[model samples]
Target: MSRSPEFVVKSPAMDIVIHSLSDVGPDQRRRLCEGARGIFWDTAEVKDFSSETEREGFIYKYFSYYMEREPELFFCAFSDHQVFGYICGVADTRQHQELYRCADHIPLFDDLYGEYPAHLHINLAAESRGKGLGGRLIEALEGALRTTGEAWGLHLVTSEGARNAGFYRKNGFTHEVCRGILPEEPRMLFMGKKL
Candidate 1:
């Protein structure tokens, strides 16, 4: 593949750089992974984890697959060399399902996998929100996924009434393709956008 696009986003207050996991140094990758975990916990809609360990493990389970196997799909936004936001996804949902054996986890995901073969998770630090970093990260991931030509579109699952729901809708994920509630949580929304 050709070089990934440069994703340096600048604002009057600070300069933010977005990079796929594949492009960062080992140290930065490690920082990004840890930062991502922190951001996930802080922004997660589900807060039923029994302990911090379980919470961290949950983050690992969802993230390690893409970080290790599809680094290019994992994009991290950094400000002053610290990770503040990120967007990560699998290019093909089948690969993620096969690895996690979660075909039945999200309702209609299996049925809709052919058209929306990719899925993503995005999070931003509290201070980073409202500054357009999330949209930039989403665009970066979409560009990378489109270049691969392996997915027809990308999808994401967020809790219904999620604060980020409006953000996703604004970023072009308008289709409320599916909905289901995970155990102990409110309804979840499966939103998608065609590439």
Candidate 2:
């Protein structure tokens, strides 16, 4: 079996702290979202979401509708005083239902994840992307999922144009389906890993 990496793993000179989103105050949330949006907006071949209102709305809705409901499912990676990476998943059935209701117009979630549990969403600032924080964030989410004893697999949907699919694959997620759920948007790739 592959051995697990030590819990204290860190980049050469960076001090990393991994904690739940609940531990981050509103101001920190704003900072993290702004930093993360800067990175996501510049990603090659992915949709740009740099508009202040759009990014703010995305982060606000995520915290209000999903993370707060399942606090353990959201995690942030911090180095020093700034949040460099973050991951959030919907592990509660009711929250997932609410997401569906709110995202009905966004066909990717409405059609593909309508019946799925534990839908993971992750983002890492460009400067923090190559330090293995992505895998650590996924591991943290898996740990949280295990605590629930649900035995169900974790699932996620990524845009085909986003290179993030490779990162998910490296962390043991497999592409299970593809749905043209959004006619105006790119194809959505649904991936999962049995837990």
Clashing pairs for model 2 are none
For all predicted structures, in order, the TM-scores are 0.86, 0.73
lDDT of 2 by residue, 1-195 (tens): 111222344777877877765556777766655555554455423345879776656655444454556555667777656777777777644345566555542345443443455667777777878788888888877877776665367777776656777888889887467767548866777787877
Instruction: Write candidate 1's Cα lDDT for 76-169 as tens digits.
Output: 8987667889888888877665545533344445677778888898888998999989899999998887777778888888768877789999
Which whole-number lDDT from 0 to 100 does residue 160 have in model 1?
Answer: 80
Q: In candidate 2, which residue ranges exceed 4 Å CA deviation?
A: 1-7, 23-57, 60-64, 93-95, 104-116, 182-184
Q: What is the C-alpha lDDT of each candidate?
A: 0.79, 0.64
> Once model 2 is optimally superposed onto the true structure by TM-score, how far is the C-alpha of residue 93 displaced, in angstroms?
4.9
lDDT minimum window of 10 residues, candidate 2: 1-10
